[model samples]
Target: MASSDSTASVPDLPSKPPAWANGSPSVRRPAFQWAPYLFLLPTVGLLFLFSLYPMLYGVWMSLRTTDVIHGTSTFVGLNNYLQLFHDPQFGLSVLNTAWYTLTVVPLIVAGSIAIAVFLRDSRPARLLARVGFYVPFVLSPVVVATSWKWLLNEDLGVINGFLKWAGLATIPWLSSDFSARVSVVVATAWNLVGFYMLMVLAGLSQISAEFYEAARIEGATGWHRFWHITLPMLRPTILLVVILATIHATQAFETILLLTDGGPGGATRLVVQNMYQSAFGRLQPGYGVAQAVVLLPVILFVAWLQMRLFKQEGVI
Candidate 1:
Protein backbone atom coordinates (compact mmCIF):
# COMPACT_ATOMS: atom_id res chain seq x y z
CA MET A 1 0.00 0.00 0.00
CA ALA A 2 2.90 2.42 0.72
CA SER A 3 4.56 1.56 -2.64
CA SER A 4 1.25 2.10 -4.54
CA ASP A 5 0.70 5.43 -2.78
CA SER A 6 4.24 6.59 -3.70
CA THR A 7 3.65 5.72 -7.44
CA ALA A 8 0.27 7.48 -7.55
CA SER A 9 1.65 10.59 -5.77
CA VAL A 10 4.16 11.37 -8.61
CA PRO A 11 1.78 14.05 -10.00
CA ASP A 12 0.87 11.68 -12.93
CA LEU A 13 4.06 12.79 -14.72
CA PRO A 14 1.88 15.27 -16.74
CA SER A 15 0.33 12.28 -18.68
CA LYS A 16 2.96 12.62 -21.40
CA PRO A 17 5.78 15.10 -20.72
CA PRO A 18 6.55 18.52 -19.18
CA ALA A 19 6.82 21.59 -21.45
CA TRP A 20 10.60 21.77 -20.98
CA ALA A 21 11.05 18.01 -21.37
CA ASN A 22 13.46 17.02 -24.11
CA GLY A 23 11.94 16.98 -27.63
CA SER A 24 8.44 17.76 -26.40
CA PRO A 25 7.04 19.20 -29.64
CA SER A 26 3.41 19.27 -28.49
CA VAL A 27 4.13 21.59 -25.57
CA ARG A 28 3.89 25.31 -26.35
CA ARG A 29 6.41 27.42 -24.43
CA PRO A 30 5.25 30.79 -23.10
CA ALA A 31 5.58 33.51 -25.69
CA PHE A 32 8.56 35.85 -25.36
CA GLN A 33 7.18 39.31 -24.59
CA TRP A 34 10.06 40.97 -26.45
CA ALA A 35 9.26 39.23 -29.76
CA PRO A 36 6.92 42.03 -30.89
CA TYR A 37 9.48 44.66 -29.93
CA LEU A 38 12.15 42.81 -31.89
CA PHE A 39 9.91 42.77 -34.94
CA LEU A 40 9.47 46.56 -34.70
CA LEU A 41 13.22 47.21 -34.52
CA PRO A 42 13.71 47.60 -38.29
CA THR A 43 10.84 50.07 -38.59
CA VAL A 44 12.16 52.10 -35.66
CA GLY A 45 15.66 52.18 -37.16
CA LEU A 46 14.39 53.33 -40.57
CA LEU A 47 12.23 56.09 -39.06
CA PHE A 48 15.18 57.36 -37.05
CA LEU A 49 17.46 57.32 -40.05
CA PHE A 50 15.11 58.88 -42.55
CA SER A 51 12.59 60.99 -40.65
CA LEU A 52 14.11 62.09 -37.37
CA TYR A 53 17.58 62.65 -38.82
CA PRO A 54 16.31 64.79 -41.67
CA MET A 55 14.19 66.95 -39.40
CA LEU A 56 17.04 67.56 -36.95
CA TYR A 57 19.48 68.19 -39.79
CA GLY A 58 17.08 70.62 -41.41
CA VAL A 59 16.85 72.58 -38.19
CA TRP A 60 20.64 72.69 -37.92
CA MET A 61 20.96 73.79 -41.54
CA SER A 62 18.42 76.53 -40.91
CA LEU A 63 20.79 78.16 -38.42
CA ARG A 64 23.79 78.13 -40.73
CA THR A 65 24.78 79.97 -43.91
CA THR A 66 25.23 77.00 -46.22
CA ASP A 67 27.41 77.70 -49.23
CA VAL A 68 26.64 74.80 -51.56
CA ILE A 69 29.03 76.17 -54.19
CA HIS A 70 32.06 76.30 -51.90
CA GLY A 71 30.85 73.39 -49.75
CA THR A 72 31.18 75.43 -46.61
CA SER A 73 28.66 76.37 -43.96
CA THR A 74 28.91 79.11 -41.31
CA PHE A 75 26.64 79.70 -38.34
CA VAL A 76 24.36 82.72 -38.91
CA GLY A 77 22.25 82.63 -35.75
CA LEU A 78 18.87 84.30 -36.46
CA ASN A 79 19.87 86.54 -39.37
CA ASN A 80 18.20 84.27 -41.92
CA TYR A 81 14.97 84.42 -39.95
CA LEU A 82 15.15 88.18 -39.53
CA GLN A 83 15.80 88.70 -43.23
CA LEU A 84 12.86 86.46 -44.10
CA PHE A 85 10.61 88.59 -41.94
CA HIS A 86 11.70 91.73 -43.77
CA ASP A 87 11.15 90.20 -47.20
CA PRO A 88 8.02 91.44 -48.93
CA GLN A 89 7.68 88.27 -51.02
CA PHE A 90 7.59 86.19 -47.84
CA GLY A 91 4.79 88.36 -46.49
CA LEU A 92 2.89 88.08 -49.75
CA SER A 93 3.28 84.31 -49.82
CA VAL A 94 1.93 84.08 -46.25
CA LEU A 95 -1.07 86.19 -47.21
CA ASN A 96 -1.69 84.13 -50.33
CA THR A 97 -1.57 80.88 -48.37
CA ALA A 98 -3.97 82.28 -45.78
CA TRP A 99 -6.34 83.50 -48.46
CA TYR A 100 -6.20 80.20 -50.27
CA THR A 101 -6.96 78.30 -47.06
CA LEU A 102 -9.83 80.59 -46.16
CA THR A 103 -11.31 80.36 -49.62
CA VAL A 104 -10.89 76.64 -50.38
CA VAL A 105 -11.40 74.99 -46.97
CA PRO A 106 -14.94 76.26 -46.43
CA LEU A 107 -16.04 75.39 -49.92
CA ILE A 108 -14.48 71.93 -49.81
CA VAL A 109 -16.05 71.07 -46.44
CA ALA A 110 -19.53 72.33 -47.29
CA GLY A 111 -19.58 71.07 -50.85
CA SER A 112 -18.21 67.65 -49.97
CA ILE A 113 -20.72 67.15 -47.15
CA ALA A 114 -23.57 68.17 -49.43
CA ILE A 115 -22.37 65.93 -52.24
CA ALA A 116 -21.81 62.98 -49.92
CA VAL A 117 -25.29 63.39 -48.44
CA PHE A 118 -26.88 63.56 -51.86
CA LEU A 119 -24.90 60.50 -52.99
CA ARG A 120 -25.28 58.44 -49.79
CA ASP A 121 -27.95 56.19 -51.26
CA SER A 122 -26.56 52.90 -52.51
CA ARG A 123 -28.39 53.10 -55.84
CA PRO A 124 -26.34 52.32 -58.93
CA ALA A 125 -26.54 55.89 -60.27
CA ARG A 126 -25.47 57.39 -56.94
CA LEU A 127 -22.54 54.96 -56.72
CA LEU A 128 -21.48 55.95 -60.22
CA ALA A 129 -21.69 59.61 -59.31
CA ARG A 130 -19.50 59.02 -56.25
CA VAL A 131 -16.95 57.22 -58.42
CA GLY A 132 -16.95 60.05 -60.95
CA PHE A 133 -16.28 62.62 -58.24
CA TYR A 134 -13.52 60.51 -56.64
CA VAL A 135 -11.62 59.97 -59.90
CA PRO A 136 -10.08 63.44 -59.79
CA PHE A 137 -8.76 62.89 -56.25
CA VAL A 138 -6.80 59.81 -57.32
CA LEU A 139 -5.21 61.49 -60.32
CA SER A 140 -1.66 62.73 -59.92
CA PRO A 141 -1.46 66.37 -58.92
CA VAL A 142 0.57 67.06 -62.09
CA VAL A 143 -2.08 65.47 -64.26
CA VAL A 144 -4.84 67.39 -62.53
CA ALA A 145 -2.96 70.67 -62.88
CA THR A 146 -2.09 70.06 -66.53
CA SER A 147 -5.67 69.11 -67.35
CA TRP A 148 -7.02 72.18 -65.59
CA LYS A 149 -4.41 74.36 -67.27
CA TRP A 150 -5.66 73.30 -70.69
CA LEU A 151 -9.31 73.48 -69.72
CA LEU A 152 -8.96 76.97 -68.23
CA ASN A 153 -6.84 78.43 -71.03
CA GLU A 154 -7.98 81.95 -71.83
CA ASP A 155 -8.55 81.41 -75.55
CA LEU A 156 -8.02 77.87 -76.80
CA GLY A 157 -9.54 75.90 -73.91
CA VAL A 158 -12.81 73.99 -74.12
CA ILE A 159 -14.43 76.17 -71.46
CA ASN A 160 -13.52 79.41 -73.23
CA GLY A 161 -14.39 77.91 -76.61
CA PHE A 162 -17.83 77.00 -75.32
CA LEU A 163 -18.23 80.43 -73.81
CA LYS A 164 -17.29 82.02 -77.13
CA TRP A 165 -19.77 79.83 -78.94
CA ALA A 166 -22.45 80.98 -76.50
CA GLY A 167 -21.51 84.66 -77.19
CA LEU A 168 -19.96 85.09 -73.73
CA ALA A 169 -16.62 86.86 -73.40
CA THR A 170 -13.62 84.65 -72.67
CA ILE A 171 -12.38 85.23 -69.14
CA PRO A 172 -8.64 85.16 -68.39
CA TRP A 173 -8.63 82.47 -65.74
CA LEU A 174 -4.88 82.71 -65.07
CA SER A 175 -4.46 86.43 -65.56
CA SER A 176 -5.06 89.29 -63.09
CA ASP A 177 -4.67 88.83 -59.34
CA PHE A 178 -8.31 88.14 -58.58
CA SER A 179 -8.84 85.72 -61.46
CA ALA A 180 -5.60 83.85 -60.69
CA ARG A 181 -6.52 83.40 -57.02
CA VAL A 182 -9.99 82.26 -58.00
CA SER A 183 -8.64 79.77 -60.52
CA VAL A 184 -6.19 78.25 -58.04
CA VAL A 185 -8.83 78.04 -55.34
CA VAL A 186 -11.36 76.39 -57.66
CA ALA A 187 -8.81 73.96 -59.05
CA THR A 188 -7.54 73.00 -55.62
CA ALA A 189 -11.08 72.50 -54.34
CA TRP A 190 -11.98 70.24 -57.26
CA ASN A 191 -8.96 68.06 -56.63
CA LEU A 192 -9.54 67.65 -52.88
CA VAL A 193 -13.34 67.65 -52.47
CA GLY A 194 -13.63 63.93 -53.16
CA PHE A 195 -11.31 63.03 -50.27
CA TYR A 196 -13.44 65.04 -47.87
CA MET A 197 -16.60 63.49 -49.32
CA LEU A 198 -15.28 60.00 -48.71
CA MET A 199 -14.35 60.89 -45.11
CA VAL A 200 -17.78 62.33 -44.39
CA LEU A 201 -19.42 59.42 -46.17
CA ALA A 202 -17.58 56.99 -43.92
CA GLY A 203 -18.83 58.91 -40.90
CA LEU A 204 -22.35 58.84 -42.28
CA SER A 205 -22.14 55.09 -42.67
CA GLN A 206 -21.20 54.64 -39.02
CA ILE A 207 -24.45 56.30 -37.88
CA SER A 208 -27.32 53.86 -37.25
CA ALA A 209 -30.14 54.02 -39.81
CA GLU A 210 -32.69 53.49 -37.01
CA PHE A 211 -32.15 57.06 -35.81
CA TYR A 212 -33.34 58.47 -39.08
CA GLU A 213 -36.24 56.04 -39.24
CA ALA A 214 -37.37 56.99 -35.74
CA ALA A 215 -37.02 60.70 -36.50
CA ARG A 216 -39.21 60.36 -39.55
CA ILE A 217 -41.92 58.59 -37.54
CA GLU A 218 -41.78 61.38 -34.96
CA GLY A 219 -42.62 64.07 -37.55
CA ALA A 220 -39.12 65.44 -38.04
CA THR A 221 -38.77 67.26 -41.36
CA GLY A 222 -35.77 66.66 -43.61
CA TRP A 223 -34.08 69.90 -42.55
CA HIS A 224 -34.79 69.20 -38.89
CA ARG A 225 -33.39 65.71 -39.11
CA PHE A 226 -30.29 66.90 -40.90
CA TRP A 227 -29.67 69.68 -38.38
CA HIS A 228 -30.40 67.65 -35.26
CA ILE A 229 -28.87 64.32 -36.22
CA THR A 230 -26.61 64.61 -39.24
CA LEU A 231 -24.77 67.79 -38.28
CA PRO A 232 -24.02 66.77 -34.72
CA MET A 233 -22.94 63.29 -35.70
CA LEU A 234 -20.71 64.67 -38.46
CA ARG A 235 -18.86 67.19 -36.30
CA PRO A 236 -15.75 65.07 -35.86
CA THR A 237 -15.42 64.35 -39.58
CA ILE A 238 -15.97 67.99 -40.45
CA LEU A 239 -13.28 69.01 -38.00
CA LEU A 240 -10.88 66.47 -39.51
CA VAL A 241 -11.61 67.71 -43.00
CA VAL A 242 -11.05 71.30 -41.96
CA ILE A 243 -7.67 70.56 -40.35
CA LEU A 244 -6.35 68.51 -43.29
CA ALA A 245 -7.61 71.01 -45.84
CA THR A 246 -5.98 73.85 -43.95
CA ILE A 247 -2.58 72.10 -43.90
CA HIS A 248 -2.78 71.22 -47.60
CA ALA A 249 -3.77 74.75 -48.49
CA THR A 250 -0.80 76.12 -46.57
CA GLN A 251 1.45 73.80 -48.58
CA ALA A 252 -0.17 74.65 -51.90
CA PHE A 253 2.62 74.43 -54.43
CA GLU A 254 2.26 71.88 -57.21
CA THR A 255 -1.11 73.13 -58.41
CA ILE A 256 -0.07 76.77 -58.25
CA LEU A 257 3.38 75.95 -59.63
CA LEU A 258 1.97 74.27 -62.74
CA LEU A 259 -1.09 76.47 -63.12
CA THR A 260 0.20 79.97 -62.31
CA ASP A 261 4.02 79.77 -61.91
CA GLY A 262 3.54 82.42 -59.18
CA GLY A 263 2.55 84.90 -61.83
CA PRO A 264 0.79 87.32 -63.66
CA GLY A 265 2.44 89.05 -60.62
CA GLY A 266 3.18 86.47 -57.91
CA ALA A 267 -0.50 86.50 -57.04
CA THR A 268 -0.77 82.82 -56.22
CA ARG A 269 2.72 82.28 -54.81
CA LEU A 270 2.08 80.17 -51.72
CA VAL A 271 4.43 79.53 -48.81
CA VAL A 272 5.78 76.24 -50.17
CA GLN A 273 6.41 77.73 -53.58
CA ASN A 274 8.15 80.61 -51.89
CA MET A 275 10.32 78.13 -50.00
CA TYR A 276 11.14 76.28 -53.24
CA GLN A 277 12.09 79.48 -54.97
CA SER A 278 14.24 80.59 -52.05
CA ALA A 279 16.00 77.24 -51.70
CA PHE A 280 16.51 76.36 -55.39
CA GLY A 281 15.68 79.35 -57.57
CA ARG A 282 17.70 81.80 -55.46
CA LEU A 283 20.15 79.30 -53.92
CA GLN A 284 19.25 80.46 -50.41
CA PRO A 285 18.94 77.13 -48.66
CA GLY A 286 19.58 78.57 -45.23
CA TYR A 287 16.88 81.22 -45.68
CA GLY A 288 14.43 78.70 -47.06
CA VAL A 289 15.04 76.35 -44.17
CA ALA A 290 14.45 79.20 -41.79
CA GLN A 291 11.12 79.93 -43.47
CA ALA A 292 10.09 76.30 -43.16
CA VAL A 293 11.11 76.23 -39.50
CA VAL A 294 8.87 79.25 -38.88
CA LEU A 295 5.97 77.44 -40.49
CA LEU A 296 6.51 74.44 -38.24
CA PRO A 297 5.57 76.32 -35.11
CA VAL A 298 2.48 77.82 -36.66
CA ILE A 299 1.32 74.44 -37.95
CA LEU A 300 1.92 72.89 -34.55
CA PHE A 301 -0.05 75.64 -32.81
CA VAL A 302 -2.97 75.15 -35.15
CA ALA A 303 -2.88 71.41 -34.65
CA TRP A 304 -2.78 71.82 -30.90
CA LEU A 305 -5.70 74.25 -30.99
CA GLN A 306 -7.71 71.75 -33.01
CA MET A 307 -6.90 69.07 -30.49
CA ARG A 308 -8.17 71.34 -27.75
CA LEU A 309 -11.37 71.84 -29.69
CA PHE A 310 -11.72 68.11 -30.18
CA LYS A 311 -11.28 67.51 -26.46
CA GLN A 312 -13.85 70.13 -25.58
CA GLU A 313 -16.37 68.45 -27.85
CA GLY A 314 -15.36 64.92 -26.68
CA VAL A 315 -14.52 64.05 -30.25
CA ILE A 316 -11.12 62.72 -29.33
Candidate 2:
Protein backbone atom coordinates (compact mmCIF):
# COMPACT_ATOMS: atom_id res chain seq x y z
CA MET A 1 0.00 0.00 0.00
CA ALA A 2 2.93 2.41 0.74
CA SER A 3 4.64 1.55 -2.61
CA SER A 4 1.36 2.14 -4.48
CA ASP A 5 0.92 5.52 -2.78
CA SER A 6 4.46 6.62 -3.73
CA THR A 7 3.92 5.61 -7.38
CA ALA A 8 0.58 7.49 -7.53
CA SER A 9 2.21 10.63 -6.08
CA VAL A 10 4.80 10.74 -8.95
CA PRO A 11 3.51 12.80 -11.82
CA ASP A 12 3.40 11.41 -15.44
CA LEU A 13 5.70 13.39 -17.81
CA PRO A 14 4.70 14.51 -21.32
CA SER A 15 6.35 12.67 -24.24
CA LYS A 16 9.10 14.41 -26.29
CA PRO A 17 8.23 15.74 -29.74
CA PRO A 18 9.25 13.83 -32.91
CA ALA A 19 12.36 14.95 -34.89
CA TRP A 20 10.41 16.39 -37.87
CA ALA A 21 8.24 18.38 -35.43
CA ASN A 22 11.22 20.37 -34.08
CA GLY A 23 9.72 23.63 -35.38
CA SER A 24 6.81 23.39 -32.92
CA PRO A 25 6.49 25.67 -29.90
CA SER A 26 7.53 24.30 -26.46
CA VAL A 27 9.35 21.44 -28.19
CA ARG A 28 13.01 20.44 -28.28
CA ARG A 29 14.76 21.68 -31.46
CA PRO A 30 16.51 19.72 -34.16
CA ALA A 31 20.23 20.20 -34.82
CA PHE A 32 19.31 22.00 -37.98
CA GLN A 33 15.82 22.89 -39.17
CA TRP A 34 14.18 24.29 -42.34
CA ALA A 35 15.76 27.71 -41.85
CA PRO A 36 19.07 26.40 -43.18
CA TYR A 37 17.29 24.93 -46.23
CA LEU A 38 15.41 28.18 -46.86
CA PHE A 39 18.73 29.99 -47.11
CA LEU A 40 19.98 27.38 -49.62
CA LEU A 41 16.90 27.56 -51.86
CA PRO A 42 18.08 30.40 -54.10
CA THR A 43 21.47 28.93 -54.90
CA VAL A 44 19.98 25.48 -55.46
CA GLY A 45 17.28 26.90 -57.73
CA LEU A 46 19.82 28.90 -59.73
CA LEU A 47 22.05 25.89 -60.30
CA PHE A 48 19.13 23.78 -61.37
CA LEU A 49 17.83 26.42 -63.74
CA PHE A 50 21.14 27.41 -65.26
CA SER A 51 23.73 24.66 -65.18
CA LEU A 52 21.73 21.47 -64.91
CA TYR A 53 18.94 22.55 -67.22
CA PRO A 54 21.34 23.63 -69.93
CA MET A 55 23.40 20.48 -69.63
CA LEU A 56 20.38 18.21 -69.98
CA TYR A 57 19.16 20.32 -72.90
CA GLY A 58 22.54 19.93 -74.56
CA VAL A 59 22.39 16.18 -74.11
CA TRP A 60 18.95 16.15 -75.68
CA MET A 61 20.20 18.28 -78.54
CA SER A 62 23.13 15.95 -79.05
CA LEU A 63 20.63 13.22 -79.88
CA ARG A 64 19.09 15.38 -82.59
CA THR A 65 20.86 16.67 -85.71
CA THR A 66 18.99 19.99 -86.06
CA ASP A 67 20.24 23.55 -85.84
CA VAL A 68 19.94 24.85 -82.29
CA ILE A 69 17.86 27.82 -83.45
CA HIS A 70 15.69 26.02 -86.01
CA GLY A 71 15.53 22.67 -84.17
CA THR A 72 15.36 21.09 -87.62
CA SER A 73 17.47 17.94 -87.27
CA THR A 74 15.79 14.60 -86.61
CA PHE A 75 16.73 12.30 -83.76
CA VAL A 76 19.71 10.17 -84.83
CA GLY A 77 20.31 8.22 -81.61
CA LEU A 78 23.85 6.64 -81.59
CA ASN A 79 24.75 7.48 -85.18
CA ASN A 80 26.78 10.52 -84.16
CA TYR A 81 28.74 8.43 -81.64
CA LEU A 82 29.37 5.64 -84.16
CA GLN A 83 30.69 8.05 -86.79
CA LEU A 84 33.36 9.33 -84.34
CA PHE A 85 34.97 5.91 -83.91
CA HIS A 86 35.40 5.58 -87.70
CA ASP A 87 36.82 9.07 -88.27
CA PRO A 88 40.63 9.01 -88.50
CA GLN A 89 40.92 12.71 -87.65
CA PHE A 90 38.89 12.19 -84.49
CA GLY A 91 41.09 9.25 -83.58
CA LEU A 92 44.25 11.31 -83.94
CA SER A 93 42.82 14.14 -81.90
CA VAL A 94 41.84 11.77 -79.09
CA LEU A 95 45.35 10.28 -79.11
CA ASN A 96 46.99 13.69 -79.05
CA THR A 97 44.84 14.95 -76.16
CA ALA A 98 45.55 11.81 -74.12
CA TRP A 99 49.29 12.07 -74.70
CA TYR A 100 49.36 15.76 -73.86
CA THR A 101 47.34 15.29 -70.67
CA LEU A 102 49.50 12.35 -69.55
CA THR A 103 52.73 14.32 -69.77
CA VAL A 104 51.69 17.89 -68.88
CA VAL A 105 49.55 16.97 -65.85
CA PRO A 106 52.42 15.36 -63.97
CA LEU A 107 54.94 18.05 -64.90
CA ILE A 108 52.69 20.91 -63.80
CA VAL A 109 51.77 19.23 -60.51
CA ALA A 110 55.34 18.29 -59.61
CA GLY A 111 56.97 21.50 -60.78
CA SER A 112 54.42 23.76 -59.04
CA ILE A 113 54.73 21.85 -55.77
CA ALA A 114 58.53 22.06 -55.94
CA ILE A 115 58.52 25.81 -56.60
CA ALA A 116 55.89 26.53 -53.94
CA VAL A 117 57.73 24.42 -51.36
CA PHE A 118 60.99 26.25 -51.99
CA LEU A 119 59.40 29.70 -51.82
CA ARG A 120 56.80 29.26 -49.06
CA ASP A 121 58.96 30.63 -46.23
CA SER A 122 60.64 33.36 -48.29
CA ARG A 123 58.23 36.22 -48.95
CA PRO A 124 60.48 38.24 -51.26
CA ALA A 125 61.47 35.23 -53.34
CA ARG A 126 57.86 34.04 -53.56
CA LEU A 127 56.64 37.42 -54.72
CA LEU A 128 59.30 37.74 -57.42
CA ALA A 129 58.81 34.20 -58.69
CA ARG A 130 55.01 34.59 -58.66
CA VAL A 131 55.28 37.70 -60.84
CA GLY A 132 57.47 35.87 -63.33
CA PHE A 133 55.17 32.84 -63.40
CA TYR A 134 51.73 34.48 -63.62
CA VAL A 135 52.37 37.41 -66.01
CA PRO A 136 51.89 35.23 -69.10
CA PHE A 137 48.67 33.79 -67.65
CA VAL A 138 46.93 37.20 -67.75
CA LEU A 139 48.16 38.03 -71.27
CA SER A 140 45.81 37.33 -74.17
CA PRO A 141 46.65 34.07 -75.91
CA VAL A 142 46.59 35.73 -79.32
CA VAL A 143 49.09 38.32 -78.18
CA VAL A 144 51.34 35.64 -76.74
CA ALA A 145 51.06 33.40 -79.79
CA THR A 146 51.70 36.29 -82.20
CA SER A 147 54.74 37.37 -80.24
CA TRP A 148 56.07 33.83 -80.09
CA LYS A 149 55.24 33.16 -83.75
CA TRP A 150 57.40 36.08 -84.79
CA LEU A 151 60.29 34.99 -82.61
CA LEU A 152 59.94 31.34 -83.73
CA ASN A 153 59.70 32.01 -87.48
CA GLU A 154 61.46 29.31 -89.52
CA ASP A 155 63.71 31.83 -91.22
CA LEU A 156 65.16 35.04 -89.78
CA GLY A 157 63.49 34.45 -86.38
CA VAL A 158 65.03 35.24 -83.00
CA ILE A 159 64.93 31.60 -81.92
CA ASN A 160 66.80 30.47 -85.02
CA GLY A 161 69.14 33.37 -84.69
CA PHE A 162 70.07 32.25 -81.19
CA LEU A 163 70.41 28.63 -82.38
CA LYS A 164 72.73 29.63 -85.22
CA TRP A 165 74.84 31.72 -82.85
CA ALA A 166 75.15 28.70 -80.57
CA GLY A 167 76.26 26.50 -83.54
CA LEU A 168 72.92 24.57 -83.55
CA ALA A 169 70.85 23.97 -86.70
CA THR A 170 67.86 26.25 -87.33
CA ILE A 171 64.91 23.89 -87.07
CA PRO A 172 61.32 24.51 -88.21
CA TRP A 173 59.70 24.61 -84.78
CA LEU A 174 56.07 25.01 -85.91
CA SER A 175 56.19 23.87 -89.51
CA SER A 176 56.93 20.22 -88.70
CA ASP A 177 54.83 17.64 -86.83
CA PHE A 178 57.27 16.59 -84.07
CA SER A 179 58.72 20.02 -83.31
CA ALA A 180 55.25 21.60 -83.39
CA ARG A 181 53.95 19.22 -80.69
CA VAL A 182 56.91 20.07 -78.46
CA SER A 183 56.33 23.78 -79.04
CA VAL A 184 52.70 23.51 -77.95
CA VAL A 185 53.66 21.75 -74.69
CA VAL A 186 56.42 24.26 -73.95
CA ALA A 187 54.28 27.32 -74.63
CA THR A 188 51.29 26.12 -72.63
CA ALA A 189 53.42 24.94 -69.71
CA TRP A 190 55.18 28.32 -69.47
CA ASN A 191 51.89 30.17 -69.01
CA LEU A 192 50.16 27.58 -66.81
CA VAL A 193 52.87 26.52 -64.34
CA GLY A 194 52.43 29.75 -62.39
CA PHE A 195 48.68 29.28 -61.90
CA TYR A 196 49.39 25.80 -60.55
CA MET A 197 52.15 27.16 -58.29
CA LEU A 198 49.60 29.51 -56.75
CA MET A 199 47.35 26.56 -55.98
CA VAL A 200 50.22 24.67 -54.32
CA LEU A 201 51.14 27.78 -52.34
CA ALA A 202 47.62 27.90 -50.95
CA GLY A 203 47.82 24.24 -49.97
CA LEU A 204 51.24 24.71 -48.33
CA SER A 205 49.94 27.58 -46.23
CA GLN A 206 47.02 25.51 -44.90
CA ILE A 207 49.36 23.02 -43.25
CA SER A 208 50.10 23.83 -39.57
CA ALA A 209 53.59 25.18 -38.92
CA GLU A 210 53.59 23.26 -35.63
CA PHE A 211 53.81 19.99 -37.56
CA TYR A 212 57.13 21.08 -39.03
CA GLU A 213 58.36 22.28 -35.64
CA ALA A 214 57.47 18.94 -34.09
CA ALA A 215 59.32 17.12 -36.83
CA ARG A 216 62.40 19.29 -36.31
CA ILE A 217 62.43 18.56 -32.57
CA GLU A 218 62.54 14.89 -33.38
CA GLY A 219 65.71 15.51 -35.48
CA ALA A 220 63.98 15.10 -38.84
CA THR A 221 66.03 16.74 -41.62
CA GLY A 222 64.84 18.49 -44.76
CA TRP A 223 64.23 15.36 -46.87
CA HIS A 224 62.67 13.57 -43.92
CA ARG A 225 60.23 16.39 -43.23
CA PHE A 226 59.28 16.62 -46.89
CA TRP A 227 58.62 12.92 -47.20
CA HIS A 228 56.97 12.28 -43.84
CA ILE A 229 54.95 15.39 -43.31
CA THR A 230 54.89 17.64 -46.35
CA LEU A 231 53.99 15.23 -49.14
CA PRO A 232 51.38 13.36 -47.12
CA MET A 233 49.71 16.57 -46.06
CA LEU A 234 49.84 17.96 -49.57
CA ARG A 235 48.22 14.92 -51.17
CA PRO A 236 44.92 16.77 -51.56
CA THR A 237 46.68 19.65 -53.30
CA ILE A 238 48.49 17.19 -55.55
CA LEU A 239 45.18 15.64 -56.54
CA LEU A 240 43.56 19.04 -57.09
CA VAL A 241 46.43 20.11 -59.34
CA VAL A 242 46.23 16.84 -61.24
CA ILE A 243 42.48 17.18 -61.85
CA LEU A 244 42.82 20.83 -62.92
CA ALA A 245 45.81 20.18 -65.14
CA THR A 246 44.02 17.21 -66.68
CA ILE A 247 40.98 19.32 -67.51
CA HIS A 248 43.12 22.07 -69.03
CA ALA A 249 45.34 19.67 -70.92
CA THR A 250 42.43 17.53 -72.05
CA GLN A 251 40.64 20.63 -73.29
CA ALA A 252 43.85 21.87 -74.92
CA PHE A 253 43.18 23.56 -78.23
CA GLU A 254 43.94 27.29 -78.16
CA THR A 255 47.70 27.04 -77.60
CA ILE A 256 48.18 24.19 -80.07
CA LEU A 257 46.09 25.99 -82.67
CA LEU A 258 47.97 29.25 -82.13
CA LEU A 259 51.35 27.56 -82.19
CA THR A 260 51.13 24.54 -84.54
CA ASP A 261 47.66 24.48 -86.12
CA GLY A 262 47.94 20.73 -85.32
CA GLY A 263 50.34 20.05 -88.23
CA PRO A 264 53.07 19.49 -90.15
CA GLY A 265 50.01 17.35 -90.87
CA GLY A 266 47.55 16.72 -88.00
CA ALA A 267 50.41 16.16 -85.53
CA THR A 268 49.38 18.21 -82.52
CA ARG A 269 45.61 18.18 -83.09
CA LEU A 270 43.65 17.58 -79.87
CA VAL A 271 40.05 16.44 -79.43
CA VAL A 272 38.83 19.95 -78.69
CA GLN A 273 40.42 21.20 -81.90
CA ASN A 274 38.80 18.39 -83.78
CA MET A 275 35.47 19.16 -82.12
CA TYR A 276 35.79 22.83 -82.96
CA GLN A 277 36.77 22.05 -86.53
CA SER A 278 33.83 19.68 -86.96
CA ALA A 279 31.22 21.99 -85.44
CA PHE A 280 32.40 25.17 -87.18
CA GLY A 281 34.74 24.42 -90.07
CA ARG A 282 33.25 21.12 -91.25
CA LEU A 283 29.61 21.84 -90.31
CA GLN A 284 29.21 18.56 -88.41
CA PRO A 285 27.94 19.67 -85.03
CA GLY A 286 26.40 16.34 -84.10
CA TYR A 287 29.63 14.42 -84.67
CA GLY A 288 31.61 17.03 -82.77
CA VAL A 289 29.28 16.81 -79.80
CA ALA A 290 29.62 13.05 -79.90
CA GLN A 291 33.40 13.29 -79.66
CA ALA A 292 33.04 15.64 -76.70
CA VAL A 293 30.60 13.32 -74.97
CA VAL A 294 33.27 10.63 -75.02
CA LEU A 295 35.56 12.78 -72.86
CA LEU A 296 32.90 13.82 -70.33
CA PRO A 297 32.86 10.55 -68.39
CA VAL A 298 36.65 10.43 -68.16
CA ILE A 299 36.93 13.83 -66.52
CA LEU A 300 34.10 13.20 -64.04
CA PHE A 301 35.33 9.75 -63.06
CA VAL A 302 38.86 10.95 -62.33
CA ALA A 303 37.61 13.79 -60.17
CA TRP A 304 35.32 11.46 -58.25
CA LEU A 305 38.19 9.02 -57.76
CA GLN A 306 40.43 11.73 -56.34
CA MET A 307 37.80 12.85 -53.85
CA ARG A 308 37.27 9.29 -52.70
CA LEU A 309 40.96 8.43 -52.41
CA PHE A 310 41.99 11.62 -50.60
CA LYS A 311 38.93 12.01 -48.39
CA GLN A 312 40.98 13.06 -45.35
CA GLU A 313 43.28 15.58 -47.01
CA GLY A 314 40.96 18.24 -45.50
CA VAL A 315 40.66 20.02 -48.84
CA ILE A 316 37.58 22.10 -49.37
In model 1, state the lDDT of residue 75: 97
Put down candidate 1 lDDT per residue, 165-245, tens digits, no spaces: 999988899998898899999999999898888788777876778999999999999999999999999997788888888
- Give candidate 2's TM-score: 0.76
Best by lDDT: 1
All candidates' lDDT scores?
Answer: 0.83, 0.77
lDDT of model 1 at residue 204?
A: 83
In model 2, state the lDDT of residue 197: 87
TM-score of 1: 0.82
Q: Per-residue error at 93 for model 2, in Å?
A: 0.9
Clashing residue pairs, candidate 2?
66-73
Tell me the tens digit of each residue's lDDT in model 2 across 32-94: 567868989999999999977866776776676857567568899988887777889888988
Worst 10 residues of 2 by lDDT: 2-11
